[model samples]
Target chain A: MTQYAFYFNGKRCTGCKTCELACKDRYDLTPEISYRKVFEYGGGDWTKDADGFYVPDVFTYYVSVACNHCDDPACTKVCPTGAMHKDADGGLVLVDADRCIGCGYCHMACPYNAPKVDREKGHTVKCDGCAERVAAGQKPICVEACPLRALDFGTKEEMEQAHGDSQVADIAPLPQKEYTHPNLYVDPCKHAQMANEATGKVANILEVM
Target chain B: MDGMLTAFDEITLVLFTTLAPAGALAYVLVALPLIVSGDRLLEEARRRLDRFLCVPVVVAMIGLVASATHLGNPANALYVITGFGRSPLSNEVVCGSVFLSAAGIFWLTSFSEGPGRIGVRGVVVAIISVLGLVFVGVISLAYDASTILTWNTPYTPLTTWLNALSGGPLLAILTMRLARFYTAGHKLGRALVALAALALVASVIVYGLWGSLLPELRNSLASAAELAPLFMPSIGLFALLGIAALVLGFKAATWHGEAPLWLPITSTVLMLVAIFLMRFQFYMIHMTVGVGV
Candidate 1:
């Protein structure tokens, strides 16, 4: 009956995969199957007073990600079989293999690439936030293993109380398309400039049908 | 012995590359549904109960069989029913059931007709058309491979859906004309045909410019060789097919014209080919998350 939340702090994150390795090891997972990933961006608009030309022009920041467990999960909506389900009280998304037809619809619909396909089993597996471990009064393997103290887990109010005041929160914006509203939020970063430059480059490449 | 290994090498590479192209088979998922419920749409006997007979039970049955290939495990396919709670695939199952139910009602009503049957016919057909198209949208999104950028966007769903709306009516009108059922009266048919054609043209243009074209290249599909294999003659053939459908459609609606079979069928077939090829080449040209590596 407890509410749960996941938080990512960009400033303290050092682009380390320690948390990822810990989570994967705990799950006995193979490579690229990490329930969590730390995404790093190197270059941006440089400041005139900046130190080195060879360094990332503007800023160097890292963002760690896991499932948001949204109240309205798109993964559940696109699931073709009854395999994917959500725990109502805590907003946890879980997949039941017994009912999974292995259609891969949930894997396609997810914006953050949260789900990893188990090609061998013909199904998907993602961060369950170590729900079983959490239930036993132990933190998720990933959160417990983070050396940077960059991750947090607790009640929704507790998360807000713990890191809510930090300068680095966008109420948790996750990377998503304009079409659907995703539950995750991004702490506003200079990603817009980089995205704009990327867009401008693609614009000149005339599309041919 | 080396030659045999070389042959084996070629086959393995080909199959691996084609694993994604094999996804192209999803198109049939949209077509067979119409064949299952198409006959009733053209006839205008008009009743939800009677339209079930339109799909041609064999055609609908084919949809079931064709769908199984896409599944990794045939026996576990039954589990698709449980996922409807969280999945569009489930919605498709439900929508298709409603469509089939409407079709069944139409079939059962044929044995006895009264004022109630007349009233029920139109409502059922309209609803089933909506439901059938909904299933197409669901299936379009269900295919998971992200490398196929053409199929990644909503464009796949929109085009997949219009495939039925545009093609089914064409088939129904053709069959009705052959049956000599007066055929949606004449003016109505022209209006429908013209409307459908206009939609097709607009959709093709959008698809050409927005979705199919490789964003990396200046001219991907629009190149002379890709767009037309027979030089300028290909354009002429495309125009001929298009204009033939439009002119013949209007003629059929006006005075006496050929039965509806040839014109719309040809139009639908050509449009389907163009879209499918566009999809195929789109697959050839697309670049996904990490191509060079």
Candidate 2:
């Protein structure tokens, strides 16, 4: 019953987007599709302190994300053809390309927007935690391609041991983790930001593209 | 949220979301009255039902075909039931298919020259009609997912269920006219028209109450204020047409063929049009929570 997870160091990530490109290249994804995305998360305000001096409460950072391969995957729950499913070995969420009706139900159900309908391929596609590469004893292309070495992946306990506890991680502009229990662990930037803060606002529209 | 909607989001799904329920409703409404008729009228009712029942079946078939078109591969759709236990969608498809098949078989039996067991046919059609209604209910609840907060509201299920009640009779009235059976002003006619009007009014009330909660929910990702304009107009239209259609249908019933054929026809068409407009806008408003935003 071992589960794999992702560890993101938001403090070091510079939003370089190399992970996005490397993922597209690895999967041969078209211009419209990218398995990995780097979000530029930032928000702030200048406020007057009790000392009558202006204080800045602003911060910006990058969050690299892909499929969380959630413990309770919503996409698999809604799939009509049993197309979207969880991999037996790593509990990695995977789609059966042959079984998918291209109904896009998984796309709608996923809170993380993990699944995308490939119009040309006539099926849904998503990150499968690089199952092939992982089985072959290689890291996912995104982790290997990170310049700052900000991304890490391994079993949940291993990642927690290497990085810190992920229970408190909050990457703003992304959804609250409670919805999906996503297997993603983020080490927040220096500025403290709580999960569910700025709930509906995405701080990084331009950088995502 | 992205202001622009893609082609698939706009039109491809309109046919399934709109026509499928309309067809299902028509079938249920048309069959229910026949199933409940007295033995004296049972023969005539069977003749009428057999002749006109195919209209709703064809409508449902067209909708089913449109749904298949949305699939990535229609050839693999026959296996939809394979995920029956895990997916509400599979259950919905299975329900819809069963209703269609049952209705089709009943309609074929109507072609017989003799009565062919009126009691049996009546019981069968009654059960099938109820199943069709349940099928519509299933479709409504199928969209209740945590990810799409806008769709998870009680309004989604209420609107679909009410539409079947409010729109079914109108389609049935038009269908009756097409079959050339004069039913205007009969007890069943008035009862059904009254049912439609009351249901339409109820649907409007529910929509208004549901809409008023949107502002508070806006912060919670449960708001769909962007869809208000498109949806609001349809509610008004359904109410107005619901009244007009009932009045015309009742008037024609009392006139005993003196009224022009167009009276009920025009009213039903307007109601159907309003329902379609609502459904088209319904699919256009699909919003999801999380990363894609």
Candidate 3:
């Protein structure tokens, strides 16, 4: 199976949230739901020097994230009806709406806040990595719509080759890579913090939620 | 708490967890007299207790119905059993169904048979009683997911089972009193009171330890403490209600004549509310290891 992955360049992303809007527009999602989100992580405070001068040590960065289609997804593990499963062919996690009871177990278990139970639709909805578009050899709308070309989607091998081998999935505002082993790879910016760091918080919580 | 509204969205589930386990255990406790005495129980007392079995049965049924409403599409509920062994939620549902079915069947059979079927009734009650306990344990395990830091702890199941123990005896006392079955100064009455008191004390300690641990549990979005700012206050309220119920229960157990009809009933209601408060806090402090809320 060829595993699909998302590649993000934190240095290029301006936190414009264009990718977020593009995915929402493609899916025609309600305001309460977003398949993709751009998290603004910012923290640090000013310190006074011995010369009585105030110095700033603040930092901020953006992380554009989607499902990541993890290898061992918590959502699929907790879904009672087996409605949530990872596809064997492309290794993309998808939900089978016909079997879903809309119990929200997937929503509760997902660390990335990816899958959401749409009460009106009576099923859990999430990003499928634009499977149809990928089948047609086209990039996802979110990746194509990014103005700075910060987002990329391809097979794991392709993403590794195009980006660098050192690119990782661990960054602030996301859990440790060991948790779910997400398929997202990031070329972090200078201000990027490790996943375990406690210095930053999700600054754009209102916009994301 | 920021997630207080999020927890309220699951009001149906909160009711389910609050009512079902305690109600199931109450059914088991109420059956103890029949199961233990068998042929020794008076025929009229046997008939009265048998008729009163419907009380706990109805309580558990109401909880099951409320839980079904939590599903966005109840028509697809039949598919839940297909996940029986693999899913924790499925395991909980299957266990609850088994216990309820056993209790319902026993209640129906009681109407057809006479006191001579004491052996059969005793055996059936024993089996359902064990199933009831199993259902409580399974429901607690259902919420112990590794990704949920606040719920994954052993304290989660500890508090849940303790809540069931604390409320079950009070409900049993209420059922016995309504049936006009005298238990004042009886060994069974004293045992029930003692069990409820011990369970209440344990629940308070477990909840206290759980609250202390919440401050350290955090993710990028929020901390568990922020998600459940009313944790300590809720526990305090629960303790107050529990003490009131125990006081009333102790009075009923030690009464010389038939206990006042309202004593056990009022105690049961207070304990149920106390259990509900803890269950509400359980949902309020829902914090994941990462960003999920």
Q: Top model by DockQ, which number?
A: 3
Output the lDDT of residue B135, model 1. 50
Candidate 3 lDDT at B20 equals 87
True-structure Cα RMSD, model 3: 1.6
Worst 10 contiguous positions by lDDT, candidate 2 chain A: A200-209
Instruction: Rank candidates by DockQ, best first.
Output: 3, 2, 1
Determine the backbone clash count of candidate 3: 0
Cα lDDT listed for each candidate: 0.48, 0.73, 0.87
On the 0 to 100 scale, the lDDT of residue B257 in model 1 is: 51
TM-score of each: 0.60, 0.91, 0.96
Q: Write the per-residue lDDT of candidate 1 for residues A21-124, one digit (tens) a residue.
A: 89878888876466776654444453444554454355445556676666555567676665677876566788777666555555545645566557566676
Query: What is candidate 1's CAPRI-style docking category based on DockQ?
Result: incorrect
| TM-score evaluated only on chain B, model 1 | 0.60
lDDT of 2 by residue, B9-28 (tens): 53655666566776788887
Cα lDDT of model 3 by residue, B154-194, tens digit = 99888878988998888888888777777534767778889
Q: Sort the candidates on TM-score, descending order.
A: 3, 2, 1
1 against 2, candidate with superior lDDT:
2
The residue-by-residue lDDT of candidate 2 on A1-209, one tens digit each, is 88888888877888898888999998898887877877666668899999999998777767788999898888999999988988888989998888888988888777677798887888998998898999998889999999999998888888889886555234565567777788888888776356566633445554443
- Number of clashing pairs, model 2? 3
